[model samples]
Target: MAVIEYQHSAEDITPAQLNGFFVGWPNPPTPDVHLRLLRNSDAVMLAVDTETRQVVGFITAITDGVLAAYIPFLEVLPAYQHQGIGQTLVRRMLERLQDLYMIDLLCDTDIQSFYEPLGMYRAVGMCARNFARQSGQ
Candidate 1:
């Protein structure tokens, strides 16, 4: 197993290092857009492979700093999935937002079990997406 490093900032990150995410999205963001997304997010946690200097996984949060936080993305590269990176990312992000009154994320039913062990509970929520802008162009 490669040495994995977790970081909370994207300061020196580049587009090339962000390849291979958003696995099944029809219009995944390009690397540059991904970089922008990371920078724009209120908080981000990244799992990087120290040996290859590649970002293998990431979770992004949008927070109001006091009351609520919404996790919009949590993804691991296909090759890196099932390696505990995703769980670690979520845990770290949650810790960072622990002071908030609410921390929320929406995921499919199939993945809800993956989060239950991490202290997240199932909740009803609604979302609206504009697929045309999914790439964050």
Candidate 2:
């Protein structure tokens, strides 16, 4: 594991530094689109590899700023998946949102266990996806 720096803001970040993410998606966002979303997000936490100077993991949240917050994305590069980067990003994001009354995210059942130990609980929710626009056009 190389030196990892966690950042809350997208300052100094560029599309070149964002690659190898959105793994396994058929129509994943390009690095440029990724950077745009990061910049637009209400809150963002990034895990960067100091040596490579690349973003290896990131989490984003959308919030009403008073009480409700929703985590829309959390991803780590495939090579960095098991290195605790994802966990650290989530923990930091949660801390940043501690003042909110609700912090929610929707993840697959298999991945629920991962978030559970980090203080998340099971919940019923509904979501809709438009794969045609998944690449963030």
> Candidate 1: how large is its RMSD?
0.7
lDDT of 1 by residue, 22-119 (tens): 88899999999999999999999999999999999999999989899999999999888898999999999989998899999999999999999999
Candidate number of the best TM-score: 1
List the candidates' TM-scores in order: 0.98, 0.97
**Whole-structure CA lDDT of model 2:** 0.93
TM-score of 2: 0.97
Q: Could you say which candidate leads in lDDT?
A: 1
lDDT of each: 0.94, 0.93
Candidate 1 structure lDDT = 0.94
Q: All candidates: CA RMSD in angstroms?
A: 0.7, 0.8
TM-score of 1: 0.98
Off by over 4 Å in 2: none
